[model samples]
Target chain A: MSKKRDDIIDTTSDLLERQGYFATGLNQIVEESGAPKGSLYYYFPGGKDEICEEAIRRSGASLEKSIDRAMSEADTAAEGIAALVEGISRAMEASNFGAGGPLTTVATETAGQNERLNNACEEIYESWRATFERYIRKDGIDSIRAERLSTLVLATMEGAIILSRTYKSTEPLQRAGAELRELLEFAR
Target chain B: MSKKRDDIIDTTSDLLERQGYFATGLNQIVEESGAPKGSLYYYFPGGKDEICEEAIRRSGASLEKSIDRAMSEADTAAEGIAALVEGISRAMEASNFGAGGPLTTVATETAGQNERLNNACEEIYESWRATFERYIRKDGIDSIRAERLSTLVLATMEGAIILSRTYKSTEPLQRAGAELRELLEFAR
Candidate 1:
C-alpha cells in the first residue's frame, strides 16, 4: 500500500476502535491521517464504509497473527490462553480502559445496518474462531467440541473487554482469563 | 414513570442500543418518542446526557428483573443460565441479530468517554455480577470463585451477543450457553 493509503487505514482503525462506525467522521480520518480528501477518495472510493471494511480486515489479520504468536509461545493451550489474557489486560490498562477493539465496536455497530461491513466482521470472527479451535484441538478436544469451545472463548474475551472498558479496570478481563483457562483445562 | 417520561426513555434506549452514545441524536429521540421537544427539555434539562443516563439506568434495572425472573424459574444455576441464554437468542432472532441489549452497546460506546454513562454501566454490570454470584454460590461454589465465575459468565454472554449479531445467527449464543453450563456444573 502507498504511504498515504496506509496512513488512512491506520488512522481510521484507531478512530473506529475508540468510537463506533457511525461516530467516526470522514473529515476526522483525513485530518488524523494527514491525507488529502482527494487522496482518500482515490484509495477508497466508497469512502467511510470502504475504509472500515479494509480496516477491519487488516486489524483482524493483525489480531490473528498476535494470537498465533501468543499461542505458540506457551507450552500448552491453557498457558497460551493465560498469556493472551495477561496481554489483553496490559493493553486495556495502557488504553485506560477501552472496550471492543476497532474491529469489535465497528462490527457490532454495523452488524445489521451495513452488509459489507457486517460480512467483514463475520469473516474476521470466523477466522479468529478457527484459530482458537486449532489451539484447543491440540489439547485433545474433539473437533466439534473444540469448535463450540472456541466460540465460547471468543465470546468470553469480547465480553470481558466490554466489562473491563466499562469499569475502567482490568479486573474483569483478568478474572475472565482465569475462569476460561480453568474451563478449557477441565474440558480436557 | 409518567407516560411521556416513559416514552422519552423507551425511544432513547432503543436508539442508544442500536447506535451508541455519539450516534444517537436528541432530536431523533424526541421525534421517535413523540414526547414533544418542549416535554423532552422539561423532563431532561441536560438533554442527551441526561436521557442516556436515565436510559442506561432504566435498561439496567429492566435487565436485572428479567435475569431474576429467569433465575427463579430454573432448578439450578446452570439451567437458569440456559434460560437466560435462550431468551437472549430469541430476542436477537426477533431483532434480526442485534447484539447485547440497550445496556451493552451504550455501555461499551460510552466507556471511558463519559464518566456519568460509564458509572451507570459499571453499576449495572456490578449488579448483574452480584446476581450471578448469588446463583453460583447457591450451587455450592465458594464466594471468591463465584464472583470470578459471575464475571466470566457476563463476559461470555456479552461476547456471544457480538458474535451472534455479526453472524446473524443464534448458534454462537446457544453454543456459549451449553459450554458455560458445563463449566459452572464442573466447578461444583
Candidate 2:
C-alpha cells in the first residue's frame, strides 16, 4: 500500500474510532490525512465506502493480531482469554472511553444499507471469532460450543466497550471477563 | 413533555435509530415532525443539543423499561437477562438488520466531542446499570460485583444487537445468552 493510502486509512480509522463510520466523511479523511485530492482519488478510486471497507478489515485484522499475541503470550486458552479481555480494557482506557472495537460501530451503521461494507464486516467478525475459537478448540471445547462461545465473547467485548465508554469506566469489561472465565471453566 | 417536544423526541429517536445521532439533522427532525420552523426552539429552548439530550433520555427510559418488563416477566434474574437479550434479538430481526439502537449509536458517536450528549448518555447508562444491579442483588450478588455484572450484561447485549443486526441473524445474541446463562447458573 502507498504511504498516502496508509495515511488515509490510519486517519479514517482514528476518526471513525472516535466518532463512527457514518459520521465520517471523505472530505474529513482527506483533511485529516493532508493528502491531495488527486492522490486520494488515485489511491482509492472506489471512494469512502471502499476506504471504509478497507479500514474495517484493517481494524479487524489488528484486533485478531492482538488476540493472537495475547494467546501466544499465555500458557492456556483460559489465561489468554483473560489477558485478551484485560488487554482490551487497557486499550479502551488509553482511548479515553470512546474507543470501542472498530467493527461494532461500522457494522451497526452499515448493516442493512451497505452490502459491500456489510459483507466485509461479516467476514471480519468471522475472522475474530475464528481467532478465539482456535484457542477454545485447542483447549478441548467442542466445535459447535466453541463457535458459540466465540460469538458470545466477541459480542460481549464489543458491547462492554460501549457501556464502558458511555459510563466512562473499565469496571464493566473487568466483570465481563470474570463471567467469561466462569463459563470457560464450565466448558472445560 | 409538550406534544411538539414529544414529537421531536420520537422522530429524532426513530431517525437516530435508523441512521445515527451525528448523521441526523435539525432540518430532518423539523421535516419529519412536521413542526413549524420555530417549534423546535420554542419547546427545546436549548436547541438541538438539548433536544438530542432529551431524545437520548426518552430512548433510554423506553429501553430501560423494556428491560424491566422482560425482567419482571422472567422467574429469575438469569432468565430475565436472557429474555431481554432475546427481546432485542427479535427486534433486530424485525428491523431487518438496520440500526437497532439509538442511544448506543449516539453514545459512541458523541462520547468525546459533545459534553451534553455524553453526560445524558452517562446518566442513561448509569440508570441501566443500576436497574440490572438491583435485580442481580436480589438474587444474592454483592453490590460491587453486581454493578460490574450489570455493566457486563449491558455491554454483551449492546454488542450482540450490533452483530445480530449486521449479520442479519440472532446467532450472536443467542450465543451471548447461552454464555450468560452459563455465568448466571451460579446465581441461580
Candidate 3:
C-alpha cells in the first residue's frame, strides 16, 4: 500500500477501536492521518466500508500476532494465556480503556445491519479464534477440546475487555486471566 | 411514565440494541415510536443521552428478570445458566441475529467517549453481574468463588452473543453454555 493509504488505514484502525465505525468519520480519519482529503476515495474506491473492512482485517491480524508472541514467550499454554490477558489489561489501562476490542463495537453495530462489514468482522474473529485454537492444541489437547477451550478463552477475553473498559478498571481482565489459567491447567 | 414516554423509551431500547447509540438517530426514534416528535424533549429533557440511559436501564432490568426466571425454573444453577444461554441463542436466531446483547453496542460505542452513557452501562452491567452472583451463591458456593464465576459467566455470555451474532450461527452461544455448565458443575 502507498504511504497515504497505510496512514489512512492505521488511523481508521485506531479511531474504530476507540469510537467504532459509525462514530469514526472519514473526515476524522483524514484529519488524524494527515492524508489528503481526495486521496481517501482515490485509494479506497468503496469509501468508509472499504476503509473499515481493511482496518478491521489489519487490526485483527495485528492482535493475532500479539497473541502468538505472548503465547510463545511463556512456559506453558496456561501461563501464556494468562500473560496475554495481562498484556490486554495493561493496554486497556494505558489507553484509558479505549484501546482493546478493536472489532467488538463494529461487529455488534453492523452484525445484521451491514452484510459486508459483518462478514469482515466474522472473518477477523474466526482468525483470532483459530490462533487461540492453534496455541491450545499445542498443549496436547484433542482437536474438539481445543476448539471449545479456545472459543471460551476468546469469548471470556472479549467480554472481559468490555467490562474492563466500562468499569475503567483492569480487575475484570485480571480476574478473567486467573480463571482462564486455572481452567487451562485443569484441562491439561 | 406516560404511554408516549414509554413508547419512546421502548423504541429507543430496541433501536439502541440493533443499531447502537450514534447510529440510532433521534428522528428515527420519534418516527418509529409514532410519538409526537415534540414530546421527546418533553419526556426526556436531556435528549438522546437521557433517552439512551433509560433504555439501557430498562433492558438491563428486563434481562435480569429473565435470568431470575430462568434460574427459578431450573433445579441447578448450572442448568439455569445453560438455559439462559440457550434462550439468548434462540433470541438471536429469532431476531435474525440482531436482538441479543442490547447493551453491548451502546456500551462499546460510548465507553470512553460519553461519560453519562458509560456510567449507565457500568451500572447495568454491575446489576446484571450481581444477579448472576446471587444465583451462583445460591448453589452453596462461597462468596469469592461465586463472584469470580459469575463475572466469567457474564463475560462469556456477552462474548458469545457477539460471536453468534456475527457468524449468524448459534453454535458459539451453545458451546459457551455447555462449557459454562461444566465449569459451574465442577465448582459445585
Write the residue-wise lDDT of candidate 1 on A38-130 in tens digits: 998999999889998898899889889988889888876788899998888888888777635887787767777888998898999999989
Q: Which 10-residue span in candidate 3 chain B carries the lowest summed lDDT? A: B172-181
What's the CA error at residue A51 for candidate 3, in Å? 0.8
lDDT of 2 by residue, B1-188 (tens): 47877898899888888777777889999999998869888888888888888787888898989988987787778989888877787777777767476887787788788888988888888888788888888788888777767877777887788778777888888987887766765754
**Model 1 clash tally?**
1
TM values, all candidates: 0.97, 0.95, 0.98
Clash pairs (backbone) in predicted model 3: none
| TM-score of the second chain of model 3 compared to its true counterpart | 0.97
Global lDDT scores for all candidate models: 0.86, 0.81, 0.88
* Candidate 3 structure quality by residue, lDDT tens digits, A1-188: 59889999999999999988888898899899999989999999999999999999998888999999999888778999888987887888788888885699999989888999998998888988898888888888999988888889889998989999999999888877787888888887
Model 2 agreement with the true structure over A131-176: per-residue lDDT tens digits:
8889888888899999888888888778777777776888777878
Task: Name the TM-score of chain A in model 2.
Answer: 0.95
Question: Least accurate stretch of 10 residues (summed lDDT) in model 1 chain A?
Answer: A95-104
**Candidate 2, after superposition: displacement of residue A34 in Å?**
1.9
lDDT (C-alpha) at residue B86 in model 1: 89
By DockQ: ranked, best first: 3, 1, 2
Q: Scoring model 2 with DockQ, what do you get? A: 0.69
Computed on C-alphas against the true complex, the DockQ of each candidate is 0.79, 0.69, 0.82
The TM-score of chain B in candidate 2 is: 0.94
